[model samples]
Target: MGDVFAAVPGAVVDETGLQHLGNPLAEQRRLAAGTALAPRADRAVIAVPGEDRLTWLDSLSSQALARLQPGVGTELLILDPQGHVEHAASVLDDGETTWLIADRADVEGLYDWLRKMRFRLRVDPRIADEFAVIGGTAGALAGVAPASPAGLPLVWTDPWPDVSPGGWAYAPVDPHPGADRDWSEAIVTRDEEARIADAAARGDLQLAGLAAVDALRVAAWRPRWSADVDERALPHELDWLRTAVHLDKGCYRGQETIAKVHNLGHPPRRLVALQLDGSGSVLPDHGAAVRVGDDEVGAVTSAALHYEEGPIALAIVRRSTPIDAALTVETADGPVAAAQEVVVPPDAGRTANVPRIPRLGRRQASQ
Candidate 1:
């Protein structure tokens, strides 16, 4: 089942399946219209079983999952002590098993960590290697059957860009672009994966690739664990609080930092959408330096050529960088000019508004 999409004609698949089917723009259009499916070969599933699964995960991550109802979908984040995002997962629970869909690169580390954390807890976390993930909007994925191990579909519908219950939003845009994002990932059995692959190869079903889906994600200002996260990425910077962080949730590894940043401090950096100058075939690669004049302020996290938007990117820049400043991204071909669109603004945090108390024995009072 390695790279199930490899047999599809014109499909260019690497370690991650199906980069494109010759035309990325056409693929993007089909995907956006809910007419194509993307084999998420780069994603892996982890299953947590036993009765303590939900509460155990609730105690360990950023989302409050203690009372999670069966068949509902959500997400969670594992943060380091200093509040840096280390792992993130899209979560779904059937009555008997809790399934986590996560970036393939982080699965081993996350599985090991989960195993280590089960200190006599009745939870068993195992990587479900026999299952694979397929992504698409609900409409496009309706025909596909999801894995139903516990009598429930294991589809992790994305709850992005919307403020989840108990979650907070730092981005102040009235109409967030992510409102139109209807993305979901479904866990499929090996048989189902092969069936879909055969259908795609026969030209019976259209398929998009990682590149096309990523472009749509960037356009929606949706941040994903693999594309937007770095060693220093705080959920606030990426506006991930909208879907991932629960403000009043029980204490987890990095809850303190999450509270502090949202209540009294601002994130050191903020995410911004860049409308890149579509003059060349060069798109900025991840970690490409982003600059204002001669000063390097940030780096591109994700960039893509969208079907409708031409070229666009998402970058994390210093919080104090002026909103109106013109920006450039350094690529091998040279500098590409970019216009900035605010995702998280400079004034994003400090929401508590606690009044300052007067100091005791002020000069006026003493006099």
Candidate 2:
């Protein structure tokens, strides 16, 4: 069944485990209209059973999950000791168990970590290889089931638009881009994947690839663990406080850093949207240098060509960078001028409704 779709025109399987079906731009359109799906081979699922599943996870991660009701969708981040994002997962519970869908590269480590942390708890964690992940918009998956033949298909609906309980929004816009990112991922069986592949073979399934999905993600200013995060990534820089981090949550691995920064400091860097020159078709590669004149102020985290908006990218720039600065991204051939759109503004800090204590500078001025 896989071979049948592998032979689809321009079907190239990359290391990311997503097969691009030739026209990514066209795929983007189909995806937006809720007619396309991306078989996400790059994802893996973990199952946690026992009555203590929800509270056990709530005690460890960055989200406030003490009350994550069944069929509800949310996300949590496993932060390093320093509050840096180490692993991220989309979470869902179906009354009996909790499902965690994370990137394949990080899932194994996450599984191991969860096992080690299960001492004296009722949590039993294991890799759910029987399941495959399906990525598409909410409307496209309107009728999708939460369970499949393989097992319980925990559906992780993205909860980015709303300021989840105990979460904060750093995006100051009235209607944030996240409001339109109806992205979702479903856990299904091998048989289901085959069924979709067979449909594609018969010209029935309009499928897209990582390229199309990622481009829209960039356009939506959404942060991805694989592309946007490094060893030093903090949730504040990506404006991820909107969904992933629960500032008031109980102590976890990186909670200290999260508190100190949001209360008294700024993230050393910030996320910016880059509009690459569309004069040529070549898109800048990941890790491309984002420069101000000859000095590299930041590096491109993700780059893609959108369907309606052409040649857009996301880069993490220095917090002190001028908002109106005209920047350039280094491509293989040459440099392309990039205009910076502030995703995380220079002053993005302490977004919660915590009461304010005037800083020393303000007191001194009044004195």
Task: Please provide, for model 2 over 100-185, each residue's C-alpha lDDT reduced to its tens digit, 9 standing for 90 to 100.
Answer: 99988899999999999998888899999888888898877664454543344567888876778787766655455557788999
RMSD of each: 8.8, 6.9
Candidate whose TM-score is highest:
1
Off by over 4 Å in 2: 1-4, 7-10, 143-153, 351-367
lDDT of 1 by residue, 1-367 (tens): 4687888999898986679999999999999899999999889999999899999999999999999998888899999999999999999999898999999999999999999999998999999999989999999889899999878888889998788998877665556777788899999998999999999999999999999999999988998888899999999999999888888888999999998888888999999988887777788899999999999999999999888777788999999999778788998899988888778888777553323222212111111
Candidate that would win on lDDT = 1
Prediction 1 global C-alpha lDDT: 0.88
Native-referenced Cα lDDT, model 2: 0.81
Residue pairs with backbone atoms closer than 3 Å in model 2 (clashes) = 83-254
